[model samples]
Target: MSTVHIKPVPVTPAEVIAVARESARVAIDPEAREAMARSRAFIDDIEREGRPVYGVSTGFGALANTFVAPERRAELQHALIRSHAAGVGDPMPKEVVRAMMLLRLRSLALGRSGVRPEVADALAALLNADVTPWVPRHGSLGASGDLAPLAHCAMVLLGEGWVLADDGSRSEAAPVLDAAGLSPITLSSKEGLALINGTDGMLGMLLLAVADLRHLLVMADVCAALSNEAMLGSDRPFQPELHEIRPQPGQALSAANIHLMLQDSEVMDSHRNDLAHAVQDAYSMRCAPQVAGAARDVLAYAETTAARELLSVVDNPVVLADGRVESTGNFHGAPLGYAADFLAIAAADVGSISERRVDRLLDVTRNRGLPAFLSPDPGVNSGLMIAQYTAAGVVAENRRLAAPASVDSVPTSGMQEDHVSMGWAAGCKLRTVLDNLGTLLAVELLSSVQGLQLRQPLIPSPAARAAIAAVAPIAGKPGPDQFLAPVIEQVRHLVQGPALRAEIEAAVGPLR
Candidate 1:
């Protein structure tokens, strides 16, 4: 196997996902290290020269006017981390915590934050060693750069908070530091503020969401193909010339994916007889690409926005090479806030259509002679009847979460944090949508797979067959009214699996 070299040039959501899945270690580029070193030297010089600098000589938030006594500088740094570590609720998942560490390392690697190389190295070591800080799931207003959650992360670096170690044990950072033969990071100059003030917390969740959503979209196409065969729907909508008239990249790609998955299927050919009876398929089957395609466009937009953000230097009071410390709003998360909301909406749409296709497969009249509820015993089993309800409920919740987080801003920090983005909410909601979407699509997959089995002796597309095979080990065909929760969970895991997702993407190509 060839090795893939990941440069620290600019990380995208897809790249972040790839790194997370591949378990690749991250390191700062040499030039970026030099840049950071230069900025740190400049910050030291600024303090020595008795120059006034924001968040360095002066206080933070509502107290920006207060000057810090030289002797109290260390106290100021420690206080910053201790006070901001106010996040509460359940701990974030270990994978998410690791992603946050990676994003933070990358941003600091940009060299504008004036953080020490040791600080970046510590974060990198945490990721490389799989030592993840136990960050909470709530308490961020998206102003001051996810201050609460990020402070929890910074606390771990200071060997003061809890962390999940590689041995799958939760340990206090101080003890872990002793065990690992490491020391806590001491805050100097702008270091503590730099470590705590960034968009990494929100961006980490968004990056993971984007990765999972990409797979969901791909599986959605395969499910659509299976439903198309079961419904005996005309493939006219996917004709390249048909979409070329409008020429949406997403539409065109969706068309190609469906066409590929349905190619050479006898069931699709039999659908030609029905095409003469019906002019077009119902919106669910014929318009699958259009609906799923629009979401593809949205995914592209979200990915672009995240890529730009992960590459940005997001700490406050950026230190420059010329000994200038400019206090600005680089840490604000408005861009990612809107992008997360957009991603939530887009991912929810994928689930919405998947549920619709489930409806199409379950409706016997609409399903073209398939048994009711997709079971051997229709009245007795009630097969898949409530599955649709669960799928619908999840889709509804996603719709509720799609509301724009960037639009609602609450003031905090004595109104010094006024006009907040609440981006952490957006990122968290995006992940929720992803998780819910997995189940929703799993229902669709179960329904579509059963429908295809009813058409046995008539094959599905190669891509669809691979997906069915991947799911079979985890979720077999519905035999009775057995408990579906386990089956559904397994299906969700399969849907999120790398091989299954890659096959679907290879068949479908880039989501528009």
Candidate 2:
């Protein structure tokens, strides 16, 4: 297995994916271990001196007014994690739970959480051994961290929760921990609180969403190129100089991508001097770069936020270099919540444009004279008529899902957390929107590929031709509409990932 050394540095989405998927193992940095020792010593001092440290001597939440004696401190932490593991609904996906665990480990390894180095080691061991905790999907308020979900994750470290084995067997966490050659760790002072406090869950989902949408946005640009070429739309709008006037980096990049991918096309050159050709294409055909590019700009902001969060130690009563521990409100998830919601809005709009392009490609009135629906038998066969309906349905759902979850909040923790980020909710909705967008892009790509094929003896650009060829096995050439549901599903699976992108890039170099 590839081993990832865990330190107090910011991590990349790729690293998170590698460890979360178990393609990589984790190791503790020696310096981090030493730092944890020192932080733990500071906590020890507070306890020995009998000062009512927040999580150490005092009870939690509004119950902070209550104090516990030294003898019951260990029980206090166990009770804390057990009580907080109160989430409901189906379990989160294994990868999301794994990513949360890995991120929480990164935060604790910073040595500011006052956790014993052994706690970090146990978490690393659990991840490396592929013992995934079955974290519940709901109940996080996103204010005092992702308390419910993270608590479920933290429970597996203490051998009190359910574990899903790599072989798909489910068992009690204690036996699974033993099988992995690990034992439950007793929580030290402040350890339980640290384990659950952070914006890591929402941040982890946001990080994954950013990585995914980056690829999908590129795919959207490629699909847009195909749609424009099929519509015989002018490429003059994609002129580099024209984009330079506006100077949006994302817009410029998208225009450059279309400019390069559609270069040297026989079909495009054929209509260059045809005065009969329409002066300009519809906005969906002409304004693709602006729409897709603006989404790219939003993604850039999300990436910046994710990078800063990766390096941050987000917890209350964080340990300082001078050996002081002070409670702070760094656990608020507003930054991640806003980023997730914004990306959802962008993804939904991208899907909206792609859906419109699908409609234009299938309509006889708007399709610029391809066979109606590109059907070989025309009126006799229904062709891809219903496919547009499916795309429209998904796009409409995405529009609804795009409504910002961050703007809504509900009181919890006895009104102590009256305002919440709802970032977890936002992250969940964004994932659904992104998945729907991929399906919508797949439909657009299948429709465009058919339109290009029907244009036939009229050759397209080398990149467009190669994409048609690459997807032929899945989308096939237009004929009497044959069982389109399976074909659409096959095409959706291919376009949802890097295969078609690989073919396009091979002919046109890097798209970015």
- Measured by lDDT, the strongest candidate is 2
Report the C-alpha lDDT of model 1 over 1-512, residue by residue, as the tens digit: 11112233556565566555566666566776776787788888877887778888888999998989877877898899999888888888777777777777777777778877878878766666656787888889888888888788889888898886555556788887777767788888778888888888888887787777776777788778778877777777788888999978887888888887777777777667653557877888889889888888888888788778866878898876566788889788888898888888878887888899899899888888789988868987899899898988888898998887889988887888788888998888788888898888788888888888777778766666767787667657756787888988888887777677676557645433
lDDT of 2 by residue, 1-512 (tens): 48777876666778898876655888989987888888899998999899987888888888877999899888998899999999987777777877888899888878888989999988898887888887777988788989999998889989898886555445789988898898899997788998999988998898888988999999999899999898888899999999999999999999999888778888788789999899988999889999999999999999999998898889887989787888888898999999999999999999999999999998889888887877878888978899999999999999999999999999886877788899999998998999899899989988898998888798899889888887788767888778878887787777777788888888889988
Number of the top TM-score candidate: 2
Error of 2 at 61 (Å): 1.0
Question: lDDT at 64 for candidate 1?
Answer: 90
Q: Can you give the lDDT of residue 325 in candidate 1?
A: 80
Worst 10 residues of 1 by lDDT: 1-10
Model 2 scores worst on lDDT over the 10 consecutive residues at 162-171
